[model samples]
Target: MNWQDEAMRYEPLKAQDLYDFATAEQKQEAVEAYNRAVNKLRSGNGDVAGIALRQLAAQYPDFAEAGLLSVCCQMLWGDRRGALQILQRFSQAGYLTEDESFKTERYLAAVSSEPARETEDPGAVVVMDGENLRRDTVKPPRLLRRASADSGVEVASASEQEAFLREHNLNLKKHHYVASRSSNLLIKWLVTLLIILLLIALLLVVFLLLPQGGKTGAAATASPGLLNWSGLRLWRPVNLFQA
Candidate 1:
């Protein structure tokens, strides 16, 4: 049967029910493990805490506290779907119920009240043992300062948070695109200029060589005396007959 069906088959177990089933040594171990996980979570080590909690829940399936705290860690890590699945699993295991206090926890309640959307804001604060444990909010770009969580101040709404992230991403992409296009255009212009300069240099070389060729042709035509000196001279026979 599916988890929902399975969950419906058995009545939910409370903390006392879980304790009743555990051995004395297992109970002591569970309590110690739960405390360590809580300490890790309070110290902002949610990743380690989450793993520990999951292991604790697995080792002692009846430990309701471990399961509930695991949900908290999932929410803290921005894993809403994961958190919900853990709750479902716990429900199926009889450690959680529809009327359990886990549902009323601030993180779950906030996410549950809203429709699932890309823009939904997972809350920045976690409630544990009737205490508000504030998480560090991400700092947005300078342009989105109005929506940022400054000095523990919460954002006005989820919509503003979504807008801030969207605008920041758009601006980053736009900057990269503009920079790339500009570099391409600059390269094209430089190449075109270099080609133009090369052509001009070629024309200048051709022009410079043309004058030297013309001078050589003129010198060859004007030096006919040199060719005549190397051959037979002109004769003066008519002058001898007159004498």
Candidate 2:
């Protein structure tokens, strides 16, 4: 019989059943089944692993380790969203912790591992392909020279990385108003031109309407002036200009 059938059959058959049943061997068989499922998952046989995981979860709901295994199986089976939902539900049920339910063996292993060692040759230089050196990597000794130059820049110093703002101005962060200034400048020019055009049009109108020196000289000369009116005696008209 299968692991589940064996477990169910032998569960109630205790006491004398312990002696009569294959309980110890059955538990070992169950572990073997679990290991087989885990191996399938590791080997990318996700569908088979997922079935095994589901069966294990159904048989062992209280097993936290099995819960973790089931979730991983779900993830490998391309049911990432399903796995996340299950984790969330388990967390809400107070059966999972912040890190415990979400932790992946891969992530935990990586976190617990040591840093990688650099095996690069110190004498050989590796230059990156680019038009500018600012954005490219240099191999070995050349890199050391560029780094050790009197410029006080260490090649490894992240804070003083030469290429950090190579194409951008650092001060630009503090001058957001520069764009506004440019826009205002353009508007000012437009307004000034409009005012100048208006002034020119007004001048043109005045010039067009006013009589020129010789254009209507005859008519202007014939027109009576205030002095001419003042000089007129009104005694003969009973003092018409007395005021």
Candidate 3:
């Protein structure tokens, strides 16, 4: 059942709702239920409120207040000792304290004198009482690290743990921004190196494909005076021997 919603809907089931003549016990029980509901809300546990609501409505439908709050405690639970104590007390109580109709002394005397008859259903009879109920609020705790059952890990006690939670509460958990900047720098340097190597490779290919030739602009044409020594007998090839 949606107990948390019900608890909030009828937040303070007034003392008058019980029987018109409100007693201190009735007032206190309403206050107690309201406070515990608030505690369960803060602790983020709806199950506790549900259990309490079921028991309270069953025991004292008129009182609309006192109840038990029990939880398995394996799930996401917080530290709420006051709420737990209220549940424990309800679990072990005798009948409803405010219910003047229930005489506990007479009931116990009858039980002791005679045992249950044959075919009598064997179920626990819940006896509700809230005389010792008190409301207490729980303060929020820090990040709690859970250990793996398979791994070799030692669970730390409350005394062993430090008062302040370390880096777990820090706003910036990692330096991802810095790492990204460094990666960008490495990529830029790699591209620059590749460009330089490509340019060097192009220059080498051009040099290798160039035509090889002997040195030029040094052999001058023979001067006319040097050739004139043989100019006096200059003649056609056919008449050069006779001349």
Candidate 4:
């Protein structure tokens, strides 16, 4: 049978049947069936694939492949928290690959670092605390405003500090600036591919039109004087008749 027919034949195999298959031939058949389902999902029937994966997971809870497939479905469905929890559980169960663990840790760290709620920008507000009025920008307020000028401390160009606070909704946090080297290799590679495709398309067009172009060129280049000497007798008779 053809490959398309072969692929189409095993669409009915379930996850339980695959797990129970002990023989090499049976295992291969099961793998092929799962691959067919995965391909179908990738081709835009993700919801159907997801239901299949969920069924697979329910049938085989300890199956690593089923767990990973369920996680993938959750991510595609936009359930980030559900995916994260699954990843965490997989990591704890030692079922996650090294790359999966790394990605999970990175996601968790980034989520934990975000502020609980937005803070108001303290724009030169010198609130009094007890007997002291302090410049409110500093996290702990280094000097009390009572000992400084009325507008607040005589701090030079606190705009940078103020701007950082306003932007991040944080008070007096030190900022670090670092320039990263630009690596535009992907963009360059894409542009090169585009140029190659355009050149290929141009060559295809030229190849398609070559016969017509050759016919036109032959007609344009051909002249009465350019004909073979054997044809001179035919032309000579015509000229004699005209005379």
- Candidate 1, residues 1-243: lDDT per residue as tens digits? 122222222222334445432555556556665665565555555544454565565555555566666655555445566566555544444434444554435435554654544643444432111122233343111112222334434434444433432332211111111122234566999999999999999999999999999998667556534232343444333444554
| Cα lDDT tens digits for candidate 2, 1-243 | 122221222111122222211235443343455555655545544444444455455444433344456665443333444445444434444443445454433323422342333443333121222323332222222222244234532333332222322222211111111122234566999999999999999999888877664566555445544222343622223455767
Q: Is candidate 1 or candidate 3 better by lDDT?
A: 1
Error of 3 at 223 (Å): 99
Model 4 weakest lDDT span, ten residues long: 174-183
> Global lDDT of each model?
0.47, 0.40, 0.35, 0.44
lDDT of 2: 0.40
Query: Each model's TM-score, in the order given?
Result: 0.35, 0.27, 0.22, 0.30
Mark the regions of model 3 whose C-alpha exceeds 4 Å error after superposition: 1-22, 64-243
Return the number of clashes found in candidate 2. Answer: 2
Question: How would you encode candidate 3's per-residue C-alpha lDDT over 1-243 as one tens digit per residue?
Answer: 232333343343445444422345644454455455446544554433433433343334333234322222201122234234333333344334543223223323332344333432212111111212112222222222234435432333442222211111211111111122234566999999999999999998877665331121112113222222332423223443564
lDDT of 3 at 187: 97
Off by over 4 Å in 2: 1-30, 92-243
Which runs of model 1 end up more than 4 angstroms from their true locations? Answer: 1-18, 89-111, 114-243
Per-residue C-alpha lDDT of model 4 across residues 1-243, encoded as one tens digit per residue: 121232233333454444332234433443443565566665654444444454444333334454455555554444445445555554555444464456456544543353333432222333333344333532211112333344534432455334422332322122221111112344678899999999999999999999999887566447442443543422222343554
The C-alpha RMSD of each candidate to the native structure, in angstroms, is 22.4, 28.0, 30.4, 21.9
In candidate 3 the C-alpha lDDT for residue 6 amounts to 33
Model 1 quality (TM-score): 0.35
lDDT of 3: 0.35
